[model samples]
Target: MSPFPFLSLLNWAKTQGRHSLPWRAYFHLSIKDLGYHIWLSEILLQQTQVERVIGYYDHILEHFPTIESLANASYEEFFPYYQGLGYYSRARNMLETAKIVTEEYGGIFPNNADELIKLPGVGPYTAAAIRAFVYDEPLLSFDTNLEKIFSRYYHGNRFRKLTQKEKTLLEKDFRDTGISGREMNAAFMDFGSMVSLNIKPSDDNKWKKNTKDYPLSDCLWLKTHGTLEIREKKKKTVFPTKDASIIVVLHENHRIYYSSTEGEYQSFLLPPTENDIRHAIQDFFRSKFNLELSVRPIHDKYFENDRPFVVCNAQVQKGDTLFAKYRKENGFFVENT
Candidate 1:
């Protein structure tokens, strides 16, 4: 009944939606079940590929099993279960949130935006997702995929956040269609994943050939726009690059000194002045391990995050008091004999 073609979208979803996904079974689940299953999956699926999350999802469920179980464990206890999933901070946040949900809220995830967003690692988009999926709230979870779909299909290829008035009107229109918010959101997810791919026009030659049979292709606003100039121009964000440095200290004992500080051993910010690099490294070693180091800059490496790191090799100049101190602190030798 909505002007936004919900019937067509629902029909498309029935045929093309990822119906068999494990987390899609939230229809009759209680809040606890939804929290355990859907919330965990959504968190894992953040910036992670669906394929990559599937095994971890099952593994997490096998270990935690419930919100209460997850809550009972500290981050240290939960680390092994969540190890391979690179973002240790997310795991920590998940543990903190689980504990809050279990101990404070009696294991019931908050259904409203205000309460939901207050949870650790739960932002506005995540809160929207939980509200729509768990509480059947009439709202859209505007992630990159949905943003692409809505921008092309409705906003004339202009990608921008919808105004509050716009969202309310759209929600009202969507509610009139009698489709539950969960199903509608799922359809958008499928349509975005299947049809509104992020392929650029120049790069779409192969995609065009592959997706020629897709029914959703007919509804793509890009088809009506014709020229690439009219399509949404992706905005690229330029991040200011910073230089960092790390020193790998090797001892004659064949053991390497390591520190968990900065989440990497011997990592520190590269000083702006070339002369300061050695002194900075020395200061860090003195302060952290109470050891003086003979430092030599090795080679620079750039990480995926676009930050450059100057790798350095260091030899222990002094630290006779080190063996006693290092044993009590986080910094340790990798293979201490």
Candidate 2:
């Protein structure tokens, strides 16, 4: 095993870890509610920032209030709360898991990893998190942060998964250090996120130079090895931009309209099109919102992909009940332009 100071890591976590996160706040609640909250928080946190998740987590807890409430809500009812949080699948999976838990487990969350993994969206990392945080079980939750820590400390670089041997060494280190699993996992996450960040080469070196006050200063690859070799950065992909259009739908009283589409990044704007701008806007409104809109070009510009796009503004037809109903049902909210 690498001669890293695992005990130092645990000591750092005791004073510096993010112990006040939303999920951790729920630990003092009822056991049934504790599992549900932790599960929801873990799923929401995947590939998302903690700052962004705080509001969403609070809103979801306020609306759903319990696992049964979330399970009983329809997709339409639930999708609103999850709007703008990319990864729609996570929300859908959470609904499915809630239903399963309510029906199969009598509303009590399963304590073991095997049973927890059967729930939708509960991957290995999330399952371990639930066991560790909610049940206080001694299990490792290997997230991206921990992955970076282990990969760099063990291999002196990243872009790889931990080998079985590395996993064993880590487990043994944790055990021998007398650190509980939850504390160890939390320490790795905090240390990796706050202290051992993988930045651009210049910033990485600067961060290394200031490591005297950082947690587990000697264990960092840059400190131990005096240098770090990063994997080659991936080349940026260039997409040939065809003609595209962004529709700005405006309702009465200065209300601006927006909708979300599924993709790698959740887009508030409609699809990019190569057809005639007017026809494309008409078709998009008809197909997606089932309403025909007359749009006028506001601006024409080229975006990052080097494609020409027209930003068109349209007004909601007077007394259009269908448009109003669609807006309400789809949870469309207005933003001031």
Candidate 3:
């Protein structure tokens, strides 16, 4: 609709994009190393902010620098570095994928979309990202950031998913520009993140003050409609309230053991219920951590994630070596003396 706006966005991204991010440097890395780094970054960035992911990404690479190291380590071995990152399943999928790559493909990632998609936890978006970033294939990563940029640029702030016909037309426009896939996709992603922001800047913001024309001035949407349109806010999904019981088991040594929820933020959870809350909590510990504890509810308080839960504390009533060993070794057991 607006001739893709490729050149303008690319030029903007060049001076202002996120260049310091560790994963963006592909020049010094071999193809195998490049794939591993990009894959890890993409998975960690899923539903997570860039600021939050940087530390974890570095910590993970520090421990497991190669695919072989990651594949050789157990989830428990990797969990400490990955803990508090939330989305435990992403780590699990990453571990599975690492093993697959190590054992099946000799520690090298597949270059094509078809083969890359077959790996664990890899979907179209991730596959596309790997191809574009690592292999420099001429493909769009097509995540929400780019979606927002395109929606506003094409539809004038009527933020909606682009249709296939629109994407095809844009791709054709992109190809006509003869930009490299690496440069174009990187520019689009950075523009969406840094420039095409969700919150509109204040009128006197430096960006507007410095330039005679506001950003995207040449785009058809902005040219035809002088100002951004305000779309009615979509209602947030209301999850059904669920009651949960959380146990904090403390050892005489001042260390505590806790159970973590999977998939969602290590945050609030709507965990499935069993016959009763006590049994559910007990069953979870027994099945998952191999620890049997006599849980007695001490108080009712909302846990860190803001879910209403029964806070129960268990003394070292039983000894589970698996927990004890890891707690000591990985500092899983935490509390000051």
Candidate 4:
């Protein structure tokens, strides 16, 4: 509402902000190098916490080192590093984008937003980010953080989409501010994350006090709406808990039988049995893999899920041809525990 809240936000960020992030450290590098780092860091940060991604970013840089290296690496080689990162599709897209950049752009990233958006996994926000941070382009990257700050400052509905006129006004404001788009973006993000947070009902007053201390002159929301209302937290739906016996069928040659299920735990798991788990394992092996194999229970553990599952491990009979065949074809190898 200050026509430029970014001035105060940027000033605040200089003293207290997330400036030490690994991606920000690459700002001094050449555009090509900076683009690669920013692209990788942005993709990795998606749906993941900054704390979780920092080590992963460093490790990925160690492995890939460059766009060409990332492009050349096989899924088998890359996926292991990305194992605990949850969203495998993002990693896949990153690999694909790296290949596109290397093959089409000759290892140089596209500087402009339009061309950058054409690359795999690079959306509007990501493209704007790359353009602003790496190419110094004056594009507004409307991430969730910026959206909240703008909505609060301008008395706009946080949940509603911005109209064309609103968008034009925001663009014009940015143009008139004279602050670097990169710094402005960072300032808004830091302000939203640190100060004017989306907090619970009871915490609204505390946040309102903090906002008043910051003192934005034209904040229509503070003037009109008064104290920021507490955002109602969504009710978490409780799922029915279920118990299952998970089988970790290990062969004599140290190859473990793993299943490729598309769920939280992507491995061979079975329901709990009243009788012997070994007999159940044998039945599963004979039915699913078409193999006659003996099995014995190794250990049992519980896995937390929508429906909590009880996982039980079992060792399979050695000399099963199907196990070897599946392992060879699918590369479904896990350490025999």
Q: Residue-wise lDDT of candidate 4 within 1-337, one digit each (tens)? A: 2475667777878887898888888546876778899899888988788889999999999998888999999866897677677555576788899999999998878877788888878998998888877776666888776776677677634554566677778878887877787787776766766776444435567646666656455665555444454356899864222345454544333343544442222446677666656567678777887754434334544456544454444333222453332242255343333
Q: List the residue pairs that clash in candidate 1.
A: none
lDDT of every model, 2 decimals? 0.68, 0.69, 0.69, 0.68
lDDT (C-alpha) at residue 323 in model 2: 28
Best by TM-score: 2
Return the clash pairs for model 2, or none.
none
Q: Across residues 1-337, which tens digit of lDDT does each residue of candidate 3 receive?
A: 6586778777777887888999998899999999899999988988888899999999999999998999999866997888666545577788999999999888888888898899978988999898888888878888777777677777766356789889888878877778778888888777666655433434446434443443566543444342465555899865322445444543333333432432211211226464655556556667776765454444445555765455544432334633332133364333222
lDDT of 1 at 65: 85
Estimate the Cα RMSD of every predicted model relative to the unseen true structure: 10.6, 10.4, 11.1, 10.0
Model 1 spans with C-alpha error above 4 angstroms: 156-165, 199-220, 225-337
RMSD of candidate 1 to true structure, Å: 10.6
- For candidate 2, the C-alpha RMSD (Å) to the true structure equals 10.4
> For residues 45-69, what per-residue lDDT tens digits would candidate 1 score against the true structure?
8888888898899888898888999
* Predicted structure 3: lDDT: 0.69
